[model samples]
Target: MTSRNRSTRVSILSALIGATLAVPAAFAGQVDTAGIQSDGSYARLVVKYRDSARLRTAAADRVAETIAGAAARAGIAGGVARGGAALPLSASRLRATASQADVVRLSRALDANQTQALLRQIAADPSVEFVQVDRRLTHTRLPDVRPMLVPNDNYYQQYQWHLHDAIGGIGAESAWETSTGEGVVVAVLDTGITAHPDMDANMLEGYDFITDAFVSRRDSDERVPGAADLGDWNPVANECYAGSPVTDSSWHGTHTAGTVAELTDNATGMAGVAHDAKVLPVRVLGRCGGYTSDIADAIVWASGGEVDGVPTNASPAEVINMSLGGGGACDTLTQDAINGAVSRGTVVVVAAGNQGQDAANHSPASCANVINVGATGITGIKAYYSNYGNLVDLSAPGGGVTDGNPDGYVWQAINSGATVPEDPTYGGMAGTSMAAPHVAGIVALIQSAVEVPKTPAEIEAILKESARAFASAPSQPMGAGIVDAPAALALALDGGGEEPCEPGEPGCEEEPPIDSTPITSGQVVTGLSGVAGTEGLYRIEVPAGMRNLNVLTYGGTGDVSVYVSRGSEPGADEHDWASTRPGTNETVRVANPEAGVYYVKVVGESLYARVNLQARYN
Candidate 1:
């Protein structure tokens, strides 16, 4: 491709795929041809048939005979057919990748009437349940025009104040050295990623966990075998009658993956935050919305599978990116499954949701172990659609429709073949979904930069503390602040000053202690204290109207606990320890008590504690 063309392709892919954090898995040979539309020239066929309980011997011979007869009568260059238990019928499609001239010749040869007759004959065959012209590819094109890399001057000035004089300029090279994310795998749980030129080189093994085969194959049968290296594009299966069959729409995963690590500075397309990181495409959402159960299973499998009879994923992912969420109370089962993954060293990142409502209005995003992300515009202003709350860990560039900012929106391409609007370079879009991957990609970069591997908690801390704070931030609900890739990577390599804390020991004199005086009804008293010899521990009285209470601390190597009692005294302590070493805060919920004084204590075995207390009223 020419430089200009390559640039356009890169820009388009970058905007669509963006950064992701997860592992790729070996591709399963499942042929999913969901997007193929019926056109006059050719018809895509889905054949359904019953497989007998007998061995493959009978079916194999029958399919072989049929193939030989078909090949003898007509000119067939290449095609695939196989027999397997999962396959419903002996199915194969006659396809040709021809140029425009070749297409014209082929169309004339088949003729309109001849083509109709051929389709009828094929459909009439008992083995073939369906046959229709494949037309989805006809309209495919490189996007016609480039997207606005930076918003128009008017949009930038009037509404996009966040990007105005932001620290990083467009294409501003980071002083921090580039690092390799080659081995780390990021699993993107979203709408499927369309195959694009920019992603071909860096894309790794991935499977469609949404399918019945529990593999990445999109087709239900192994009747046809194709290339091994290519990933499967399975649409989510329809569970309800009202739900449409799975089809690729927004190309959400592709965009997120490109951002996380899109073969940066390869003299072709846009640079990714961690260009070397490998992306694992895990399809979760399809037509309308994905199910909570499927999402839960995807999480388990992505983080190394085998959660309650769901097959153990063939490949384990180090990080999983979930850019989808639904409204509901956080499910305990889901939370436990996530925690199980975290305990296994898989970092889970979730979108805070795009509703612009409180995060408590959502689920998995509201789960404790996951890193909940909110959205900021190109100019650094919070996107109108970004969901926020104390649950949000940080924010990143999630493009906005109304306001425009350099940082407020990402400039990248949409999948031209998918239903989403296709733009060459940049299109304005917004969501916590866009913001979550920014952090996931940053995590990949940090993992690449650091010598000693950081735990998920430590990685989260570096990102949160190193974020760029917006001067006019709307609320603390936005979390620490917008993500800063360079700053976060720098902190990661520098170790972020993490150390062990001990009980009753004079806390880090340098680090501020968590001190609270007023300690009101619904407010938490928070501070960081050093643990000297033993783990750090602290106690406070839970005031009235405080229905729940918990503690948060950093720089400890052991378990932590939160104790609560109706009276101003310690009861049986509820120990909620960190699952990993070099841990960050631990929270415990306490039931509301009668109007009277109550005690809340935080203790860490063998370390000092930097504590942040939080309380919610009944």
Candidate 2:
């Protein structure tokens, strides 16, 4: 394989796959509707009231009335001024959010400026906790192109190269021999999953949480049971926003769920990564895009949390696959929901976006406690449209047919209808949306393979340690490496196999014992150097009451990695936090670290010189 010129390869690719592939660098003849404006364009607000006995015990109607009064006092009653014209501000009532009763969703006709002003005024009320715009999120899928040369024979062994290909696959076939993800549940939160013979059996009863009538295309603004695809087809261009194009309903949830748990060994169509795992389809996205508030509620509900009006999830998922994303920092509502899910032992996996830019600019992808997955092609190189940055945790096969690799798209089950449900068939699609589920399925495999379930942090550490090296150095940083399913399963079964010395254990020297170097807080060491096979160790004493522990290595040159652990020796495979970006720049942050002696290890992936290392806490 040869490398292509990155500067010249930014163009729309429309061969092999009939649909025009939207490359991140360019979109020709069509607008990439997936790109959303992060600021001042929203028409809704999410307000969370402060937690108090009075607020908690108040009636839902009473709470709604209080929120309404606050909004009215904020000068949000009349028409909103935009572009020298006043837009009608509908008399909207506040509705309690399903996930948390204290939180409410307010919809009205307002431009960006009025929304911001209203939010500020509402937040000033003593009864209010926090308020922000209800941002919109869209599925991360690029177009799926039906391959012309698909054989009439078994597609699993022939076309599903991403599952078993040694260079680009997740080694799902090998891992299947040990674990088929039995008894594990995974939640796919995208456009609702449709009825497909290939994946129907594995799907549990789901709910449609889209509350807006226009977005849901339903009779009224109400969240109903049963997660079904209502066809997010846009008949008219610009219906979603200014310049948004007309498009067909992408059965996105069904495609992603098929990749996660579609039936295998049935002598049938395709093989899913975790063929035996149960899928809990959660519908949050719809026409245009779903509101961030709705997606947040689904996250909490799918993880066995209590939603105000929804039934309890009898079978809460052990893992969540969010193949959807949008721009901006993670909102407070979404973060709170994710925090709740992680605390309940659910591992969240999200797409690194298809922007071909820094992933830090995207939400959920940049959110904490999530496994941010980037896309890799059959050649084991980063996909051209995949978002790349230090925040990306790993890479998986999301296909790259448009990047001069004509046959690298991921094949899976899809609907045949252009605007609604039809016959079940197979097709090839590409994007970080596809990449995320591969990792999510692998996580299920790991969970099933182990005798005991691991914590989110432990599972993450295992994945990073077991990832496969890229075929060659990538042009940009794409996480630790491509995810290796077999390696990750083996690591988990072996209990992560690290024998770090714990604090208060005998033979654990308090001082720097000859082999290690001692460093102090707020200290910076420069001119550090190492070879490919060499290792550098440093230790620091963290006191109590410090809010954060930060160990960073940057400046100078060469490829270096930083690993940190509390009260134990850190290494490549044994550390609480690991930062292994491509270059010398690396950072490991530990929140509310315990008071103890922490170990830091710096290892070179290649020959290195003149590196700087620092340790600080506050």
TM-score of each: 0.52, 0.77
Q: Poorest 10 consecutive residues of model 2 by lDDT? A: 6-15
Runs in model 1 deviating more than 4 A are 1-172, 175-180, 212-248, 307-315, 401-408, 418-428, 497-618
Query: How many steric clashes does model 1 contain?
Result: 68
Scored by lDDT, model 2 comes in at 0.77
563 Cα displacement, candidate 1 (Å): 26
In angstroms, how far off is 433's CA in candidate 2? 0.4
10 residues in a row with least lDDT, candidate 1 = 1-10
lDDT of 2 by residue, 1-618 (tens): 112111100011111101132232232111111123523355566655555445455545545565466557656664547765654333243466654434444545466655655555555555555666677889998854444333245588777879998998899888998899999999999998888777889999988888888888889878888888888889999898777898988888888999999999887788899999999999899899898888999999999888877889999999999999888666667777888999999999999999899887787887788888999988888888999976787899999733433357888888777888887787778899999999999999989888879878777778877888788777887877889998999988988724345657897654444357899988999998878867888989887667777889988888998877765677776666788888899888765565667888889988888999999999
In order, what lDDT does every prediction score?
A: 0.49, 0.77
